[model samples]
Target: MNWDRLQEKLSILSDAAKYDVSCSSSGSKRTNKGGLGNASFSGICHTYTPDGRCVSLLKILLTNHCIYDCLYCVSRKSNAEVKRTAFSVGEVVSLTMNFYRRNYIEGLFLSSGVMKSPDYTMERLTKIAKKLREEERFHGYIHLKTIPGASPELIHEAGLYADRLSVNIELPTQKGLELLAPDKNHKEMVKPMDEIKQGIVQYKDDKKNKLVKSMKFAPAGQSSQMIIGATQESDLDIVKTATALYKKFDLKRVYYSGYVPVLSDEKLPALNTSVPLVRENRLYQTDWLMRFYEFEPYEIVNADFPNLDLEIDPKLAWALRNREHFPVDVNTADYHMILRIPGIGVRGAKKIIVARRYGRLTYEKLRKLGIAMNRAKYFIHCGKYYVSNDYDSLQLRNLILHSGKSKYTKQFDGQLSLF
Candidate 1:
């Protein structure tokens, strides 16, 4: 193995892997028992160095060589401009071990473009993961990106070694998949996710029944990703699909990657098209409201309003649209009602519930409990502070939007806060 050629391959493959957004290492409880490393439940690759260098996961692809040509993808097999390379299983193992030892990365986030057959590529990926676990005794988090049409047997074997697994849904709708990625099938993608979910369930049942000493099958659970803004699919379409995936497959996370125009195909957006980062951010906020805040997909977006308001977060947008639910009495409101308030988070809502038991909360006291008073003040009434002016919905929305703008201005001006 030539070290120089390996480094060249690493640079190309790592850059190619950045398009994948489903690599978060959260909810994995793989502990190091006389092993090289441990998988923390909190997450990995989320830390910053003293010089502000991010020492996160070593995210890379096993190969950039592909047989199928997806129009939206930069590493599509037909793209002659892209530098192609593939990493042997041994090279990946050596790199992962070395990176862990040097403390450059806390874990591995491995993906690949299709090389030869799906099963052929998957078998190699599984071997790298197996070597990391059994041969190397490396306990650091391993997140493998499973191929869509890979056999169920290889997927099950992958779960035995990987802490987490992901299968990229690629696009929001089946129509989008058919248009952009003719080589991919929506049903094929969901098949692996379903198998992985069942494997996780089976492992738990085995452990409970004492059928196995330690039933390990992706303890962290599975996740998937969707490329946003590629097709004309609405935010409603995206979130609705995500909601179904969570309900049907019991997925941990649904990552949304803003479509960055890389390949200039007539079927795709122009190469100069700006990345819709803010739209992606709004989708994530909408996702959080659904997962943590108990928000339905329809509540965030509907047939009339199929997209989220780009100006504000989804929680605030929902509150604005449904003003009749507003002005909730913070002191007397239930936990769910308090959570529905614009500025109050899960932690803040719990705090309000506990604090109200002792005494009624004022705006000042609410601020101390981590509420974003600027936004919440419009929707919540507590203590002696009653909203004097009954502003219309448009007026109230402008007030909140301006408040957000001002807060960001102050932050840029170096107005720092302790909490």
Candidate 2:
């Protein structure tokens, strides 16, 4: 291997892969079979896992050369300014093994631009993964980005080795694709997603029926990403698209990437415009509500409110809008109803339910159960302690905002919350 050339390729391709945010390695329990490494169910990305383990992965692209001219993409074919580089299959496998041995990364996240064709690009990706698993005997996590128009045979081979697969939709709506990337459409993207979903289901069914003792097809399940603020699509549109994808494809995750202006185009946001980080964070919070809090898409966002409130979270926003559901008696409310309160999380609600079996929960006891009394006080009541229900929606919103700010100022000396 040419050391200088390999270093150059790594510098460019690794930087290019930063734009893709769907690189998470959770839900895979690929154990070490007398192999090199193991993939825990806790996950191993550049983020903290559920058990507070900070794991990292070697996220990089195979190549930056492409055949499509996506206006929003920095690695598009029409952009002649970007320095292009491609990594041979051997080089990628070597880099992953060397990195894992050196304690630099726990796994590999490989994506690429459409090199000669979709099949050509996907073939190289699958080959790299195959080499790592079969030849190198690597059991660590492997996440491969599936090309939209790639052949199903190649994708199937990829699933045999990879722990997780992802296909980025790029944009929320078909109209956005038409405007920014005329060559791509939602149909082609959905095809690969459906294929991966079916593959996972088939493996599960076969294992359940005792037809096969050992079979692994993308054991971590599949996920996708959509670009926010790239085109004219409301939050409602994004939420509905995500909800449909989860329902139809059984996706494990749907990531939201705020658009960063890399190229100037008539159809794209300006270079000086700020990235919609707040909107993207709000959308992720809304996704959490839908997944964990049992919130329906229409309940969080509808035609009446097309965009999320940048100031507050989706759960609190919903509680404020429908005041009739407030003043919930925590002592008697069920799990789902208590979950609707602004300050009560899923764990807190479960704890409340378990703790109430002994005696009536007072305000202090409820606080001890880890409920945020600053916001929950206005919407819930315990035994003998009831917050006055005289404040209207507007007044309640202002009060909550004020109290939250004051508490932050007092606790942390006026430092704002990052989220």
Candidate with maximal lDDT: 2
Q: Count the clashes in each prediction.
A: 1, 0
Candidate 1 has its poorest 10 consecutive residues by lDDT at: 404-413
Local distance difference test values of all predictions, in order: 0.85, 0.87
lDDT of 2 by residue, 1-419 (tens): 79999999999998898888787788999767798999888767663322233448888899999999988889999888899999999999999999999888899999999999999999999999999999999999999999999999999989999999999999999998998899999999999999999999999988898757756999999999998887879999999999999999999999988887777765454533645678988998999999999989999999999999998898999999998887899988889999999989989999999999999998789889988887787777676555555567777788678774322211133433221
lDDT per residue (tens digit) for residues 1-419 in model 1 = 79999899988988887777777788888868898999988767943422233437888989999989888888898999998889999999999999999998888999998899999999999999999999999999999999988999999999999999999999999998898889898899999999999999999888898656754999899999998887888898998899999999999999888887886676554434755688988998998998888787888899989998888888988887888886788988899888899888998888999999998897789888888887777777676554423557777788667664322111223543212
Clashing residue pairs found in predicted model 2: none
**Model 2 quality (TM-score):** 0.93
After superposing candidate 2 on the true structure, give the runs of residues whose Cα lies further than 4 Å from its correct spot.
46-55, 266-272, 404-419
